[model samples]
Target: MGKFAKWLGAGVGFTLGGPIGAILGYTLGSFVDGFSIQDFTQEQEEYKQQTQQRTRVHATSGDFEISLLILASVVIKADGKVDRRELDYVRMHFVKMYGKDRANHAFKLFSGIIKRQISTRQVCMQIRQHMTHSSRLQLIHFLFGIAKADGNVSSSEEQEIHKIASYFYINDYDYTSIKAMFYNESDSAYKILEITKNVTDDEVKKAYRKMAKKYHPDRVQSVGEEHLVGAKEKFQKIQSAYEKIKDERGMS
Candidate 1:
């Protein structure tokens, strides 16, 4: 039988908090020998419990994926229209990460749920529920990348991503850190500060100083001294942001 014939013709459905992706991924990967019925049942039970736990938390990886789809769709549609080029970028990213078959499956699943126009906050909360601090930070970083992929970050996109990040449980320090990492310039210096565009110069300096201290590797030893490496990088960014802003405004 050809590959398409093996797809069970189920039309790829989406449900809240389910193990279907794991099941499908496992099944497709095991096509040569077939999945053991017993193993499938056991895996389903495990996946169900894991899914439930994640849903109860803030955001599962699944929720993150769905939220990404939502944000992409929203961003593309923000200018009173959706560009095929932008949509293509999203689809291509999915294909690269999840493979063509699973990517298509996920896109179909997303399309069904997106029509409901679910709350973006709810999606971020779902991610925060199950993700570690580091994971949440990474999600924020990814969101910025997606925002920039199409060239500009509009007010709508910025507002949407800000709302979504709020639910992800990322604190101001971490959120700013992630934003600065992606959006800051290499030479402009303010790229590292992580201050908002609306903030006053004094506030920017204060925030940068505070964040630099908090992320100081020596101060966060409980999470592991090794993590200080990350903190150091973050602090450097903060320093850069502060310097850039001061230079631009000619502040003392």
Candidate 2:
């Protein structure tokens, strides 16, 4: 948890209150061994001071990681049983994204999290209040990735992820667009661009440009460079979708 400690102050900002705070405090305080109960989240006081100085700021990398753990727990158990593949997907992604040691700390906390009861809506409310739109979209993408890890996304898992997307205030078009990335629906390309297959070639081109900018990795740069890789994946999906649409319509 040394790296977790290093990011303690940086990651604890707006997430230190309400559900996110209570849940994290409990996980670290009661379950995680390295932390102290007296002041489990030592950065609580620091978080308050920083909040007073700013408003609705972007979530730091540490904050994003914590949020990911909470939502991941909710999604993993949504189907009534935890699939090893889904768990492995999350763990491997974290290891790939943050390396071995930090991912280990995350899994330790994640283990405790999955063992608890989470008020999904309330937890999401706290996240929506503090996290940026782009970051929230990334969360949706990650949750879908998790849901599909076991080969197919179950109905229950898709419903839970859809609820999270709604709680995050993601519009239906955007949610479908992200959802389309992992599925092979007939109009997947159109959905990825937030457009309909019936649209004219010109409208398709316009939607492509709009979505390209919207999903650009730079939109969530404040979340930190570790996330750019994931963001780039989402961005590339948009690019691929456009290419598919262009080929279908025989556009130049």
Candidate 3:
């Protein structure tokens, strides 16, 4: 198989169908001919095992990159036009994840995707089917990072992100928690901890611990160094949120 074919078939030990498959088919068409659907049945069982092992070694490999690229294009175009800042932001992340050469190639693919209209719901649902909760959460975090690349997350960008999160089955609390990290509005501390003002001191501490573990960078080490960096950013927000709550409540 070719590079794009191999990468596109990396997730779930099989090729993805639906909108993701369609997007890959269209975007990768020029570089490779016929870009047909993958067949897993002909492969030896050992190859399947090796593929699964590779997935374990690199949690963000293969279709995950494709998914990120396509959905990222959607987020970049959410504001009606793509901003250079947003493109740079995504390019940096792609470079970190795949290095300079693959990032350049992927960015070219993204140029195609950015021109097309995508169904956020369809894409999110497809991702939710194959990705774990942590992976989906990281994907949302990346999207928010792109949206705020210009130093502000517009209402349109936020709305598009919210729609993606809803389709991914990410609860409002989790969604807002991630949102607070990028957009520092009032009640940000509360949002980061995924709690309300009505919560007691014990609840605040509990929420802090829960969020701390949830966003710890180590949790995503298997995914890649790029994801670890993003996770650390989220983990720091959780720590800051807890500290703010502790200072205000005098919880020694």
Please name the candidate that would achieve the greatest lDDT relative to the true structure. 2
lDDT of 2 at 126: 86
Give the lDDT of residue 2 in candidate 2.
59
Q: In model 1, which runs have C-alpha deviations exceeding 4 angstroms?
A: 1-15, 18-64, 181-190, 193-252
Candidate 2 residues lying further than 4 Å off, grouped into runs, are 1-4, 7-10, 34-38, 41-46
TM-score of each: 0.51, 0.92, 0.81
Assess the local accuracy of residue 164 in candidate 3 as a C-alpha lDDT between 0 and 100. Answer: 91
Instruction: Estimate, for each residue in 139-198, the C-alpha lDDT of model 2 and write its tens digit.
Output: 999999999999999999999999999989999988999999999988999889988878
How many residue pairs clash per model? 17, 0, 0
lDDT per residue for candidate 1 within 1-252, as digits (tens), equals 145323322222131333333333343344424545455456446646765645343433344455456556655555565555566666776676556995786566445433444445554554455555654554455556566667766677667667666777666656656665655355334434545567787787787777676555564333334334445655566676676677777888
Runs in model 3 deviating more than 4 A are 1-15, 31-60
Quote the RMSD, in angstroms, for model 1.
Answer: 9.0
| Residue range 156-210, candidate 3, lDDT tens digits | 9999889999999999889989998886666889988989989999999899889
Q: What lDDT score is found at residue 117 in candidate 2?
A: 96
Task: Tell me how many residue pairs clash in candidate 3.
Answer: 0
Q: What lDDT is obtained when candidate 1 is compared to the true structure? A: 0.54
